[model samples]
Target: MHRSGSTTHSLFLSPQHPHSERTKRRPGLSAFLCFLAVLAVSLSPVPGAAADHRRPAPPPAVTAEGLRVLPAVAPVMSCGDVTGVDLRRAAGAEVTITSAVVVSENTPNPYCEVRGTIAPANTIVVQLPLEGWTQRYLQTGCGGLCGNASINYGQAAECPVVEDGTVASATTDMGHQGQNDGSWAAGNPQAQIDFAYRGVHVTALTAKALITKFYGRSPAYSYFTGCSDGGREALMEAQRFPDDFDGIAAGAPANNMAVQNTYHHAWNVLANKDADGNDILLAGKLPLIHDAVLTACDTLDGLADGVLDDPRACGFDPASLICAAGQDPAACLSAAEADVVRKLHDGAVDDKGRRLEPEISHEWGSELAWTLFVPVAQGDPVSSEQFALSYLRYLADPNNPRPDFELTDLEFTKEAFWETMQSSSYMSAMDPDLGAFKRSGGKLLLWHGWNDHHISPQSTLAYYDAVRGTMGKHAVNDFARLFMFPGVEHCSGGEGPDSFDVLTPVMAWVESGRAPASIIASKIETADDGAETVSRTRPVYPYPAVARYDGSGSTDDAANFASYTPKREIGPDYKWLGSRLYSSDYQTWCRAEGTELVCGQHRGGRNWLSREAGR
Candidate 1:
């Protein structure tokens, strides 16, 4: 996947050089931790500390009444024309401006689309509305491994919001030009750094500087939005640069980055393979497993609308699908197939009950997609295998730099898992502290589909809990909110209502001090050829509050539903794996004992580090 779409334009008017904005070499663990400590203090507007001078004034309104007073443009520009503008920056001569043209709006509003590259590798685009400037800036996120900047749907809803309000929006490829290819980061250190955190951050800063030059004033407010890896970027902005965004909306954040792509993904792929190396859990059997899961749990939330509103509470046993003596393998799952589903629902865990990663909800909404990585037909490695192999071959193993590394060379034991974590410290963003973000008056809206298979909703839940545990519940609620979408898969689309406007509520909260209690989600009923018709709407309440039926009337209408606070389940405690990247308040005996067989200690309990685990 090489850089595609429109070709780049010449450097127009770049005021600052890339050299001026150049980042230092990636920090070591000790240096990064120390930098975080200083950053927290610097971002916090606590008493006695210097006041934040960068905090901008309230943005001007772009209301119809206000638009009446604005001046109209004399000449409308074309979509691929940039006649007069300078954009040369010091990063290097390699950076090129691909295009700068006016995009005709559906609402008939016009905006300039400025596209460019950043030196060695980085595709960036900024869209500046020609009128109705709201003094707000938005940077959307890229999905998967962020190989392409054009794959950003993070701002799907945001584009309209920004256009309507005349807000400027920008997006970047996150340092590569392909999509879902781990090979892009194979030997590229700068690309890896950009993927890890730099790309989005640089884009945000560069976009803002360009916006200021275009509009003669900086944006009053800034935001970052993304899901999946984009979600990771959103968190990275909030965590690494607390002042970057006034509001951030992250969905299904792959914050446990390296772990998910490596160990967790490997665990899922390995689960599908049998003793003879045959994949019994083929795509054909998905319906069987899905029906079994739905039968046991679809009605758990007071409605049986082909979606599980609360899969976590539904105790569906996969062993029930195990065939009796007379049943055929095609009709009923063999013991091995049932075991695979069980492991997926149970999540990745060591010999002990300790969860390596959160359980991927293997319900009706997400089961079909599970077959994507199962090499049932050709015995070839799937995307997960490709990703894992690349990570192990290039990034994870310091000595083994061979690109030809096979999936079989990788081990799945606890020791092997710990070893992988050791080399991936710079990649993962599992840090739980959000005090800096909160104190900086940054508002965070986190959401994840309950039926997400790519990244577990439980992982997001765990992260939210960590923030709450580290910062008190009330304190977290003051600045951050979590909305769990039941039955939605990955970022969107599933058995449940997946379409919703999280951005509107988050922006309202950020600007007006009003918090969002619930966001309405809708599922459209499509015709035979997939043309959308009427939609079934429902309100997605914040975490702990689920949409329960009102007992009568149309179940499809959101009016018949109400938010109900369910009894809270005691979720996973924040247990730290002995990754040099992961921070720990307690010690793991496996790090001390060097084996899981004899490891024993107070699980999830906080304590001082032992000499061995401390290493």
Candidate 2:
């Protein structure tokens, strides 16, 4: 079929309520007669029709009740007909059908795009192909407090994948509209719920029902995929609603939502500031740190290409970079500058000397990117400043504007720490155990860049280890696997090879039972003419297994490397507060695994909302 131009528009609000007008439209006289004639013959009694198991079933009809009939080769639904289709309540949500049309953006297939808003402020969009459907439904998740339904699932820059024209896709606007604004959650209980979890769950159920109506049968398999905030959503689907998807691919997940945003982001900003309150970490200093790290640890895995194969094994000390006697200011860090590096390696800690978060030591390569979150020059608010400000002012305290926030304003008292933890509990996806998800026969694939500057990759490792501790390593590995790229940053580009396909492997595992042992990742070099060439390729193994070189072969080729399991290191516990909020299922799983320490004991606590709003 010929492709059409891309189309997009907001949904049209009808005067009548959606639920009150479900399928009340009637076909014209000619179309009604035709439908009646077909219905009569289909309903006519056949000789032993119920017992005729050998007889072939009639050809599937391309039309359904309450749907405007169209040829399979034509647009899936007319704009006029789409606005008229009634969207009744599903999963206790009343959704308004706002806009619908067919979109074709230089693809082999055209698709019907449907946009709607679930009551209480959540928007969802679903796209179904007109032809070449593989009988599969794919729901894409959002990124970083999503306020818009970015249709960025199939061809995201971080983990680009070949799109299957037969697979349908959908996305949601996670409750509100702001590109990094957290003030929308203020005093809106239902909206907070929608952003945290309801938005995705309700969107999936609605999309699946719509797919059944359009294609005349339910999809054979369902899948979910996203990175960053989308990655958190993927884990949420597996943890909170296990039966929604058959497989999930999560990349660089911000799963520890509460702690990562408030505690971790604040810690990074403060660490970069000088004693005089100036942003001393300049862009010019990044290369020096990166080079020092590479000089010290690049050959740990038998290569010297400037990328750390496994940075956790590298024990580089920033104290070594302290300026010696008669050193140039440009070449070496002064005592004050060196202190910034030390705090970055040390991470967050309370006054009592207990660690609140793990150190992000692998961020040396992407130190320049850290400037985005924090101010690089005077008068510029750090990137995390606004996000943390909104979270604290609106979600944590409605009365105070919190206008005079300084880098030193963040304190780690137990009262303030628990306040941050308890306030955002309704919106986090930090639970570790996946017993219900595993029981549902779901498969999950997770990946993270080691040099990720946005969310520390170490946090992901901690969660993975917690999962192993809670459910046993073998049991967790059977249903979920995590792959780490050596120098990749925050789900996308870095010094190491980052581009790879997670969708194909997850699909194969779900449909054909082929679990991926090691997926080959490639870094493509694009020429001036836009011609792409694969410059490097490496096999990324599951967690705990590092890729080691064989004796004497082309180092660039993946065939020269083998998977080797490294010895686990015993480190200090971070004692993150969010881990104590898992459901009873996780507690039960920990008990069954003979790890009672994994179960959460502090189940009782003071209500966060009971405090003064101005605090």
What's each prediction's clash count? 15, 7
Candidate 1 Cα RMSD after full superposition onto the native fold (Å): 11.7
Clashes of 2: 7
For model 2, the stretches where C-alpha displacement exceeds 4 angstroms are 1-80, 154-162, 361-365, 373-379, 396-407, 569-615
Q: In candidate 2, what are the lDDT values of residues 1-615, reduced to their tens digit? A: 100101111112111112110111112222332232222111212222133568866432322211112233323545446666555544355678787776666554566778887665677777777776656678888888788875665322222112335567777887787645666655454555566676787777777777766766666667888898899899887877788888899888877776677777777677677667677666567678778878888888889876777776677787788888989878888776777777776667678755566655335555545665545455577666665665655544322335455437778765576656555555556567788888877889888988887788877787787778889989997888888888888778888887666765665555544565776676767779766666777778888787888976888877788889877653435455334543322211111112111212123323322232124
Q: Candidate 1: where is the Cα deviation over 4 Å?
A: 1-98, 105-107, 155-160, 163-165, 350-354, 359-365, 375-381, 398-400, 528-531, 570-615
Q: Tell how far residue 507 is off in model 2, in angstroms.
A: 1.2
**All candidates: TM-score:** 0.79, 0.80
Cα lDDT computed for each candidate against the true fold: 0.63, 0.64
- Estimate the lDDT of model 1: 0.63
